[model samples]
Target: MKSPVRVMLIIILIILVVAGGTVATAMYLKHHRHQAATAATATHQLSAKEAAALQVSLPQMTTNLQTSGLIQFTVTLQADKKATKNELTLMQSQIEDSINQIMRQYTPDQLRNDKGLNSLKQTILKSVNHMLPTGSVTNIYFSQVLVQ
Candidate 1:
């Protein structure tokens, strides 16, 4: 016959093993779910038709930099939805003015690299989103960027 102490020890060991497994499984599932969500976001891409429907393209703009030189670029703003696009269209002049003001803050050398251009785009995106009563700007694309 088994001793009482031995039986109790075995029961405790079994409980510990089961509890550990349950905790591990819960953690593993949570980690994988988070990874899957991140992967889906990273892989998602908008089709051309979808992009066009949500985008507002501004005409070519020419402005002088902070101190010297001239910069010319065609900006395309991507809105979060159709209503935002329509709002952006209606407020095109204000958007242009904001872009012009932002451009003046940078020098020709500031917008010469991808880093600078990306910074400019982020700044524009933030500014435009602030102007809108609803919805928001998701991105900014510069089709043509010339600094001379």
Candidate 2:
């Protein structure tokens, strides 16, 4: 029993409401997409030059094997970047001296342990760093270790 004009008005109002909602959703989606793009751009990260400067080289080593006293075990040691090229040339002798002093105390049995070897590597890094002018040997690598 509603009037025809009233029914038409109600339908027009409903259409207007639905259209408003669609416009608001499209605006929100556009804004959120832009925000997401900016966040991705902000996350582009880089490291400092000093942090990247440390270079590691793997050097092989030979150790006397436990059995028969004649066999040898070989290992590779990774060396970190020294303060300078001169430090690398001269530091090896002093670092070798320090390592020899510490290693002489450990028997073949102690060296057999994986954790012990890692600790030993750290120890060598520490000792070598102390002798460098810059006071840091970033790391050590063991590429090919042979124990005989």
Q: Count the backbone clashes (under 3 Å) in each candidate.
A: 0, 18
In candidate 2, what are the lDDT values of residues 1-148, reduced to their tens digit?
5799899999999999999999999999999999999999757443455434544342333434333322122222332333453465556656655665655555566566798678867887777667777545555665544443
TM-score of each: 0.71, 0.46
Q: List lDDT for all candidates, in order.
A: 0.94, 0.59
User: What local lDDT score does residue 128 receive in model 2, on the 0 to 100 scale?
Assistant: 69
Q: How many times do residue backbones clash in model 2?
A: 18
In candidate 1, what residue range of length 10 has the lowest lDDT sum? 41-50
RMSD of each: 3.9, 12.8
Candidate 1 positional error at 14, Å:
24
Candidate 2 worst ten-residue window by lDDT:
69-78
In terms of TM-score, how similar is model 1 to the real structure? 0.71
Candidate topping lDDT: 1
